[model samples]
Target chain A: MEENKKTCLHDKHVALGALMSPFGGFDMPIQYEGIIEEHNAVRNACGIFDVSHMGEVFISGPQADAYVNYIFTNDILSVEPGQCLYGMMLHEHGGTVDDLLVYKRNSNDYLLVINASNIDKDVAWIMKNAEGYDVVIDHRSDELGEIAVQGPLAEEIVQKVLGLSLSHLSFYTFGEFTIYGDKPAIISRTGYTGEDGFEIYTDHESTRRLWDELLAAGAKPCGLGCRDTLRFEVGLPLYGDELDDDITPVESGLSMFVKVDKPEFIGREAIIKQKEEGPKKKVVGLEILDRAIARHGAEVLDADDNVIGTVTTGYRGISVDKSIAMALIDARFAARDTQLKVRVRRKVFPAVVIAKKFYKKSYKK
Target chain B: MSKIYYAETHEYIRVEGNEGYVGITDYAQKALGNVVYVDMPEVGDEFEAGDDFGAIESVKAASDLICPASGEVVEVNDALVDNPRLINEDAMKNWIIKISISDEAELDDLMDLEAYEKYLESNPH
Candidate 1:
């Protein structure tokens, strides 16, 4: 295995006595104070996260828009500059490569924010698929640093601490700002936690200072542990767990982002066929009747102990206070009210098929 | 007076004659963070030594609770069903289960407090 990398805020996390672990090939902080505390803070008040490990690639050229549209599943033509769209990059076989957010800086320039674990693979895939497209694909995973300030009171904290105005920054939109008189930064009103938040992108030095500023301003410094729980509660898909090389976006219940009616794109034919015929497997939510959590890779079985599906992600919810899981199962058993059992360890837990969205998304739509 | 024996998996059994109160150690609870739920085995359920009887779930992860010695569960801590955080507050005071020892000789194979401390020192989490 290669040596794990550290983000610019590694020293800060250590000083805070955070529980550090290897995640996505980086020595990242899993928790600062505790996962439950940080999880509640993001749901109730405000929390700051060191998301510097996320990958960023810039695509710019005369044909950047066309190239990105061809590679991405969402319709980029509908969004204007400074707008963001969430979609997946799929292979010709309709399996997902990675789910990412694309920021339309302009007709010629676009910023693609990808998962940290998929940085190398995503960059290589983009470059390999850029054979005839007139575009410059620059992987900026290391040079740029990112932070997410999320929660209900996130706007208040960002406005008061950063001394920056975000009143006009609506959801899924970003704007460039000059911070501290000279440092230019990109602040986007977007997040993965299904809350009102902002993601700031800047240099490493600026990011370090900004983290300290957020702490001093009374925003809780959270880690990746609660980040997963918070995102899971609202049914947002994680990269490897929910969408992977073997899982297509259509089967992951993300077909809304896959524009089959759009004029020609990669995996369009396969995706269109899947949409017409319906995917063989579909993602659905299950509420376990027992307290045991049916974690990832746990088998979902039918009445006679036949394996019907597998769990993608599961959690004892902090906000909802219930044992819930999302599983990819046979499409025939994806309907609500269907009875299924999850094998957790040596025991099988009875669960009922429910809406995959355990908690309602509170995005400012 | 009760004699406490520790397992390498961090479970502790406080034995008083033929009865043993089984619970996780302070070290285990501290490592598990907030204890959200404790899946306890029902009374009269038999378990062999090192058998996984239940699980202790935290906000981030879940750990299986293994039996330290072969026994039959006589009582379970019903309080943990609603307030599992009691384990985090005080692991020893809030024992998870009470078992009637089926094999008292198994205690000889377990570690004492002194030996458990040494075992903990050799391994760091």
Candidate 2:
């Protein structure tokens, strides 16, 4: 395999004795102290993540809403001026182009946060989709960087560092603010970990300075390992794991976000068709009975030795002390009480399909 | 008191009479990060040299516990089911499994403390 590209924080991570690995085209830190400890830290205290590798694209124009709503699967028009919408851009054939968070700055301007690996493809896809529409799309993925401060106490660290109270911010809301008067950036109360946190979008050139600033302000720097466990515990859908081009949003149990009532979106017809005809499969969560973990490609088998599904993602689930996983399988097998077998290499571990929300949120809803 | 011997697979073995206490090395535990689960061997199982006796599942990956020396499983660490960190806290002191060694000569092939550290130098995570 080829050597992975390094992020701006590569030197900082190496100096901190972080274990580095290639993730989404960037050489990133996998862990610092450990995965579970950092996970628990984010749960109980606060942790800062170097999420600069995530792509940030800016789309501006008077017809931004019309263009956004036409291509995105969600009702992007519902997003308030200072709020962000977690949505998906769809391929014409109903597959997902990319799962994104479209932050509306105003009626005319919007920022689309997309996955790092999908940035180039997303830009090309978005451009191709907007060929006839009257809109200007900018793939500022290289010009911008992002970081997330997550957990229960993240609000305090943000306020302390930037001298601003995030108390006024609601979930999925954002505002452009200046940090120490160097450059203005977007700070949003949103995160992947299902915790009370914020994702800051700033200039790519100024990110390293701000990262050091946040750490100096007493935010514990966390790594990717903890991010996986934190997101897994809450049953958040991670791209390439819970989501991919091979799986439709409806099949991944994200049908709730797909508004069939919305007229003429890219994948609307397919989503409506699926709703009317019923999908072949549905995603379900599994809680293992033993110590064995269900990995991304592990087979979810039945008692009869037939493979029913494949485990999408899994983790230790530090708080629960057992393995928990999500799997997209035959819709007929999507029952809360249904038992399944996960083959972990040679051993077969017993598992059961459970309702979503592996860990309940205590957020200010 | 048992004398501790180390395996080339990074497992530690403590010899008490003909019985051998088995667990992973400290280096392996540190590399594994926070251990979430310890899959143990069945108490009645007998294993050959280099056979995977059990596994330790961390948050990222599930790793096998290769048998350093072959033996019948006399005991398995049930405490590690919940407290797998014991392997990290004290690897040699807290044995994961105890086995009756088939041959004492096979133990010589295993690396000792000084040689094991030397082996770790070539292979880095």
* Each candidate: chain B TM-score: 0.98, 0.92
What Cα-based lDDT does every candidate model obtain? 0.93, 0.83
Q: What residue runs in model 1 are displaced by over 4 Å at the alpha carbon?
A: none
lDDT per residue (tens digit) for residues A55-76 in model 2:
8777878787888888777887
TM-score of each: 0.96, 0.93
Model 1: per-residue Cα lDDT over A54-100, one tens digit each: 99999999999899999999999998999999999999989999999
- Estimate, for each residue in B1-125, the C-alpha lDDT of model 2 and write its tens digit: 77777876789888889999899888888888667778888898999989999888778888899998889998998888778877778766777899999998898888878888988997776
Clashes of each: 0, 0
Off by over 4 Å in 2: B1-5, B16-19, B44-46, B103-105
Please write out the lDDT profile of model 1 over residues B1-125, one tens digit for every residue.
Answer: 99999999999999998999999999999999999889899999999999998999988888999999999999999999988999999999999999999999999999999999999999988
lDDT of 2 at A220: 81
Best by lDDT: 1
Task: Tell me the lDDT of model 2 at A206.
Answer: 65
Candidate 2 collision pairs: none
Identify the leading candidate in terms of DockQ.
Answer: 1
Candidate with top TM-score is 1
